[model samples]
Target: MTSLNVTTTTLYMARTISLCFLVALMEGLDLQASGIAAQGMAAAFQLDKLHMGWVFSAGIFGLLPGAFLGGLLADRIGRKRVLMASVALFGLFSLVTAMAWDFNSLMIARCLTGVGLGAALPNLIALTSEVAGLRLRGTAVSLMYCGVPLGAALAASIGIAELAGGGWQVVFYVGGVVPLLIVPLLGLYLPESAQFRNARESAPTGVVRGLFREGAALPTLMIWVSYFFTLMVVYILINWLPSLLVGQGFSGRQASWVMLALQFGAAFGTLSLGWVMDRLPAWALSALIYVGILGSLIALGLASRWESMLAAGFVAGFFATGGQCVLYVLAPHFYRPTIRATGVGSAVAIGRLGAMSGPLVAGKMLALGTGTTGVMMASAPGIVIAALAMFYLSVRRNGAQID
Candidate 1:
């Protein structure tokens, strides 16, 4: 390529990643909003743990179809269009969540908000991977994903600040409005995927057959396994950690601090681990992330002191969220551009099942008097399974590269 071409490609990649990062930021904030607002939301709606669990699960359930349909649509229409629509949908519902008058209304709003949030993710991953190409895919995706944690941290800060006179609705209000503001910017500046456009003339593959056919079956299954378990742990922590901390005798303010630390750790982990993923051996990276997750979970369960819990939260966020980023990075390698979003979306949709299950399970365990330790310990076996599956994928990926 000429210097001019190289410069243009660089510019395009920068633009795409930057805009995607902004969207990821809003997505992250909204994902964590319910958790941050849980206490107030529960009190406002007169909800118990089981009811809260349903509330959490309701939003996650929307993610399942959103991811699949979003990716499918991106392949047929375009990534940029699907992403913008997803953002607008989530933003609108987030506002509705703030204005919710009853439990049913709240659940309905969150579920719709979740659909938008879920749809945005696959396109974000697909767009980042395509623009960065094979070489910088990990770094670029990680960099974009870092927005999630930072945005979560911002939400935590809002919680800590007791914004809008500490009204829980304030967080939702912010989450809703900012994404709407971003929609026009995306429409004006975000470029469609060059790879997707280039591949448009080729015969499209059947969605199911595309994912399962050829040599993709095993990798697809493995990715699903890893995503399911990894996200289960991540979502459990994201949605439950604050409440768990409060249950353990800490003040809500203290829990917010720990949550903030966790988000900061997540941002750092996402960026650092993503860079390492490109340079480190896949098996080694897999080992590092899972081991960190296990250790963090143990520490979180055992820690009693406020400082110790904060530290544990940081470590948990680092490995759990970072490991999730690894899965997102690896997914694009298994499919061509024609179905890349479909493949990633399918895996993400499967992961959402895990995500939905985790909070409800924890809610049940807590209601049954099992406590935080039991919840943390129960997650261990799944992490081990996820580790082994990821190890297999890492080994397989070493010998395979997609254009």
Candidate 2:
């Protein structure tokens, strides 16, 4: 490429990456914030682990509609406006959540925050894919997603420190405050996805129905199933692994440290996946990751020991999270600019149901007296099914259409 082309690419990539990173950061904060605060909330409210899971799951539940509505809103109005609105809403809910005195109140606040989380994700992914060149789109999008793991890691580290000092309430306070600080920067620096801008005039009003009109039904369904299954398993790991480890005889501090390792491993997995995606099909790459997840989960179940548990945690993080990164990268290609936001948002929204289900499943597993091995193994079917669905939908098999 010419110097001018290189410069433009560099600048655009930076902007895209920044937006994605921030979105991922916000998502990480939103999801992990509650996890960080779990113990504190439990003590303050005199609750059990299952109830605490509800608090964590509430935000995810809210994300379901937030993803759809945010995408639709972005399609009708614009990505920039939707982004600003969601960020503001998230900050507001985070603030409210910090002030909440009871389980019910906190649940309501978390649900609202979930909406913001859901709304922000699809548009952010769309933005990254839009600005990236076609050749580098997968890698660029994957790199942008690194923000998720980094944000989660930040949450874990900060959460541990704050909880140590001021208790879990401090974790919520930090979650509420930090995003508000980023709000000014987001307003000043974030730009609309270039593709969204170009397609604004031609975009449709009805997001869901419009997605299915042009032979989009089958592909859309496949994407939804594949995305949903993968995320359900991934969210389960994120929400319960630490506590599960505690059940396996590790100390609470050690469990938290293990969780940190998982998140960090996820960060590396995303970066590596991005690089590999440049040379492979996104679906195929995802399939490979899912296979790894199945293997890891089975091994984790059979380990019956600490060193093996730690090793399993790392591999599960690598496969489960790394696979989800592919869906985010592949999202932009599934729709034209006119409805790209809606498509991506709709996919995320649908997938959020699985995200919601993940913890619920884990909760049920815990209730059933299932051991650590059973809990970890439960994720395998979701991964395998999603992989099969995706392989069937690939362009390689049937001349499939992405947009």
Candidate 3:
């Protein structure tokens, strides 16, 4: 390519990543909003642990279909249009959450909000990957994704400020309004995926057959396993960690601070590990992530001091959320451009099942008096299973190039 063409390509990639990062930021805030607002929501509604779990799972349930449909539609219409619509859908529902009058209403609003959040993600990933091309895909995806953790940190700050004044609704209000404002920006500035446009001429394939055909069956199954288990652990931490810390006698303020630390770690991890993913061997990266997850979980279970808990939270966030990013980066590599979003959306939807289950299971376990240690231990086996599956996928990728 000529110098001018190269410059144009670089500019386009930067613009795409920046816009997508904004969307990811909003999605992160909404995802963490329920968790940060959990204490206040519970108090307001007189909800117990199990009911709170249901509330968390209800939002996650919406993600399942949102991801599926978002990807399917993005493949059919376009990533840009689907993404803008998803953002609007979530923003509207977030406002509803702030005004919720009853437990049932709260669940309905959150579920709808989740559908928007869920739909936005696959489009974000697909856009970033296609723009960056193969060489810089990991770094580009990571840069966009790190916004998620930073947005979560922003939510923690909001939670801390609101907790002092007893205005939990403020977080939802901010989450709602900002994304709506961003919608116009997306419509005006975001470019349609050139790759998607090019691939549109090819004959479409059946979604199910595309995912499982041409030696894709094994990778698809493995991707689902990895996504499911990894997300299960990540969601448990996202939703339940604050309550767990408070239950262990920390002040709510302290718990919020810990959550902030975790999100910062997540941002750092997402950026650093994404860069490392391109440079390091895949199996090594997989091993590093899982071992870090295990050690952090142990630390979280055992730590009692405020500082120790904070450090544990940071480590856990680093590996758990970072590992999830790794899975997202790997997913786009497994399918053709024509069906890429569909494949990614399907894996993400499966992961949402685990995400939905995590909080509910943790809530049940805690309600049964199993406590934090028991919950952490229960997650260990799943982490191991996820690690093995990821390792297998990495080895397979090394053996035969797909695409």
Candidate 4:
């Protein structure tokens, strides 16, 4: 009887984890839908590179408040409730994005959708950890989180299929509609965070303040810098790689196929990096990953041939996306259980600032007539900064709570 009970509990935990993956997948699909559609959106709106950059930044900017407020709300309410709400928010706005008739409306809808997507993440991480026992917690969370890139890969596949002739609207329609449908399933089957419910809520405030407590300043700052730089690289790739490819003379369809390679490489990186981090010192391995990433970016600058383009993109995705994943995997190691969600959430929220800057900066560079080579060259420093920070993190790991 006890054995059967244990088996049933394990099965239930697995189901919870699977649901988290779906939610993460929803975020990936919705977030990248705009990027995939950027060229079409620009054409539809009759906008230039600079204007389109704002559109990109708008959604990412929305992510900041979305993550901050979302994490707080999730703590006050329940992770399941907040998760469902965020999913609904993004889904509804995504539909609104599809129907947008002008640039302003499109920007508004995407930003609002960003809110929902941003809010969903911390809860997903928190819930994933809440259900997982300590021994398997890191592995389980990383596995579920890989759904984000997989969703991005699937979004690229939509373009590859030329569904609706690769129309931008089709991307949002599918992105919005699918999550709406998933909401019912989550509401019905997903459970709230049991730990959150049982614990005495920490005054429902002072969330960020906790990170600045004694002995927690430098590591907190270092991790935040790492998250910022890494995400800057990650999201610049996410939002502009497709459009940049188009600028480099590839067709939209072809660009998306390459972007698909990038996202899939990211998925591979996330999984592989997690495995590697378990076996080696994370900071040292991360430095190596950034080295590979820089090389890939430089090579990507020179990728004029189709084969070279694909190969460079894959390597860039492998290292950049993979390195970002390494950051995510290493983030939670800096906090105790009580503030695990808080520390990770704050870092991710700060990273969204970097994500916001990426597209806009790329737009400015392109507006100044920077070619693919120059653009790729310009972005390499983001990873270099990230590598330096992570290396420092390894040497001066004093800012974390020493529980």
- Give the best candidate by lDDT: 1
Better by TM-score, candidate 4 or 2: 4
The C-alpha local distance difference test score for the whole of candidate 1 amounts to 0.93
Residue-by-residue lDDT tens digits, candidate 1, 215-316: 999999999999999999999998999999999999999999999999999999998898888678877988999999999999999999999998999999
After superposition, the stretches of candidate 3 with alpha carbons farther than 4 Å from their true spots are 399-403
RMSD of each: 1.1, 2.3, 1.1, 2.3
Query: Which residue segments of model 1 deviate by more than 4 Å?
Result: none
Q: Give lDDT: candidate 4, residue 7.
A: 96
TM-scores of the candidates are 0.98, 0.93, 0.98, 0.93
lDDT of 4 by residue, 1-403 (tens): 9999889778877888899899888788877777888878888899898898898888898888888777777666667888899899999999999899998898899899989988888788877776775555667777888899889888888767653575778878888998999899998999876677665365336656767775667778988898887888778888888888888898877898888888888788877876676567756686679888888888877878877888888888788877776676666656654565677677788989989988888889999998777877787777788788887765553343222
Which residue runs of candidate 4 sit more than 4 Å off their true CA positions?
1-5, 163-166, 201-205, 392-403
Give the per-residue lDDT of model 3 (tens digit) for 43-111. Answer: 999999999999999999999999989999999899999999999999999999999999999999999
Candidate 2 lDDT (Cα, whole model)?
A: 0.77
lDDT of each: 0.93, 0.77, 0.92, 0.79
Task: Give, for candidate 2, the lowest lDDT window spanning 10 residues.
Answer: 394-403
State the number of backbone clashes in model 4: 0
Model 4, residue 289: C-alpha shift (Å): 1.8
